[model samples]
Target: MKTAITAVSGQLGRAIANRLITETGKDNLIGIARTPPKANDIGIEIRKADYNNRKDFDEALKGIECLLLISSMDHPQNRIPQHRNIIEAAKARGVKKIVYTSIVGDPEKNGFSPVVKSNRQTEEDIKKSGIDWVIGRNGLYIDPDLEYIDQYIADGAIINSAGDGLCTYTSRGELAEAYAHLLTQEVHNGKTYHLVGNPISQAQLAKYINDAFNTQLTYKAISVEDFRNNRIKDLGQLVGTIIGGIYEGIREGAFNLKSDFEKAAQRPHKSVPEMIEAYKQFRD
Candidate 1:
């Protein structure tokens, strides 16, 4: 069976493409990216496809049996339209199955509802498309923590407005592995999988950091206003607003779902503390 992975040049996309290549061989896989040249190093057939351009996606999707539709990072308002184009193209090209990367939690009820509204719409569209499909509602990734590790270690504290909220964090690599497994099996068709790891509170996350790096870092729950102010000072208003929304979602128990990662990948998912040990630079 032939398969194509969209946005193959991106971090999660590239990881999923690599896993697909290893499992199904390079000949059976196609890497679709806005810039096809960027995926040349992936050692597979590369096709130029853009989510915004229906023509680009239609031509690239021809003859593919299964298509992995990686969600667009554009504004929420634009995402559903972009996804519709891909879904339409998949139907036109006779693609048998579509696998979508979606966010965990109910968009209608979550604090981060605005961010995931488009995802819910896309899911509904996919279901109505009359194609065999799998929706992987991926958990929040823990990799972002690496970017702020230095500051967190230096400050000896991890501050947020999560306030006893829990999040199930999984690594991108493992999530990719699980996706690869799902794509190869026909049994998973029409199933929605929650691809997540263990759920832990902000305080438990802080403890993991302290234990992993041997630092005296503490989890400090601050008010939303204070958290937004601090994040704005460091990361600008746009990012601060985004982070604030995520924290609000956490507080509302949006990302606290039980995951099927182990069942999907047939292995134990990595925990936060385990990930810290795997990446030694966090200790440095």
Candidate 2:
């Protein structure tokens, strides 16, 4: 079973590729990225493929039996077209199956609607392409906590607009492992799996952080405007707008959906406390 992973230079892609190498073999895996040198170094066949270039995708997808279409990191306007190009290329190449990484929510209803909109469109296209497909609607990742930890500690609080909103946070590594299992098993075809861990409110998350670092911290619920302003002050407007939309999505109950993550992983999924504990070493 010859398999290809798009965006192999990315963290999730790299994790999935590494797992595939262990499960199948390096010889059967192809790593597609805009820059192929890093993937090449990993001993997988490297192919230069850019989501923006149809020819690049076409050439890279050739001879692959299955493809993992990692969503493009571009803005929504640019991302949908790029996904379309890849889906067309995969269809033309006679690829047997495709597994797409999607977001956990109804695009039309989510606070971050544009992102989920693009993902939904791409999913629809994949289904219409007549290729066997699996959609992994991944939950919000806990990794972002690492980036915001310093601020949280300094402020003695984790501030957000999501008031009592619960999010099922899964680690990127766990999500990648689920993708690997989905790719290796034929039974997963045509199914949409929600790859998420147990849900925890931001208040609970704050408690976990406090416990891990031995500090007194709180979860402060702020207005959307206040949160946006604070984020803008800290990270500029554009990034602030993007992140604000994520919290808005949480507030709208987008990330509250349940999942079969344990079943998909063939083991228990990591909890928020466990994830926080692992990061305790960086707390001092």
Candidate 3:
């Protein structure tokens, strides 16, 4: 049996690809990316599958038994149709299973509802598509803060619209490991799992960073409008709007969900402090 992972050049894609390679080996895994050359180093067969091109998926997913559909970062308007392209192609190509990396958000409460709505639509479509499917509703990835540690110091604090609301933070690496099992196991079919660590407020996140990297920082809550216009100005409108919207959801308590990570992965997720300690060792 063969498995394919889409968006293989991305951070989450790369992490999942690596886990698949380690757990199931490279011969059975295919990395699907828009630019095949970009993921050439992942030690597997790389195939071209642009989300916008329905025909590309027909060719790329050929003979694959299972698929890991990493959610596209395309604008919400474009996502549903784009995802349909693959789901249709998967059926045509006889791909038996598809595991999607979706997100956890309250569509009514989240300013990021547009994106969440699209994902939910895709989930419904998948269930109706006559194919075996599993969906993982991922929490907020902790990578942005980890990557922005230096900037946090330069700015003298961590600032966002998240306020005192708890964010369900999980790491890409941890989620990837779970996805490897999700992609391969039939037991997870027809289920939606919340893949998250314990929820933490922005100030608690700062405290973990301080404990790990030995930096003093505080969380500053700001208005969603201010964040879009000022704090993430460098990210431009599209991304800044989406990110600002996510923080707004955080502030509204949309992300404070309990985890089903153990049920999904058959193991408990590591705590924030435990993960931070591991990160510190790697950084050192």
Best by TM-score: 3
Q: For candidate 1, lDDT tens digit of each residue in 1-284?
A: 89999999998999998888778788889999999888899998999988999999889998999999999988778899999999999999999999999988657653356668889899999999999999999988888875688889888788889899999988778888999988888888988889998989998988887787687888888887787777778877666666777887787788899888877888989888887676665346
Give the C-alpha lDDT of model 1.
Answer: 0.86
Task: Give the Å shift of residue 193 in candidate 2.
Answer: 0.9
lDDT of 3 by residue, 49-118 (tens): 8999999999999989999999999999899999999999999999999999999997765458888999
Residue 127's lDDT in candidate 2: 92
Each candidate structure's TM-score, on Cα atoms with residue i matched to residue i, is: 0.93, 0.93, 0.96
Each model's C-alpha lDDT?
Answer: 0.86, 0.85, 0.90
Q: What CA root-mean-square deviation does each model show from the true structure?
A: 2.1, 2.1, 1.3
Best by lDDT: 3
Question: Model 2 residue 40 lDDT?
Answer: 72
Q: Which digits, one per residue and each the tens of the lDDT, describe model 2 over residues 1-284?
A: 89999999998899899888877888889999999886776778889988999999889998999999999888777888999999999989999999999878657753367788988888898899999999988898887875678888898899899888888998777887899998989988998888998988889988887777787889989987788777778878766766777887787788898788876778888888876765454344
Ranking by TM-score: 3, 1, 2
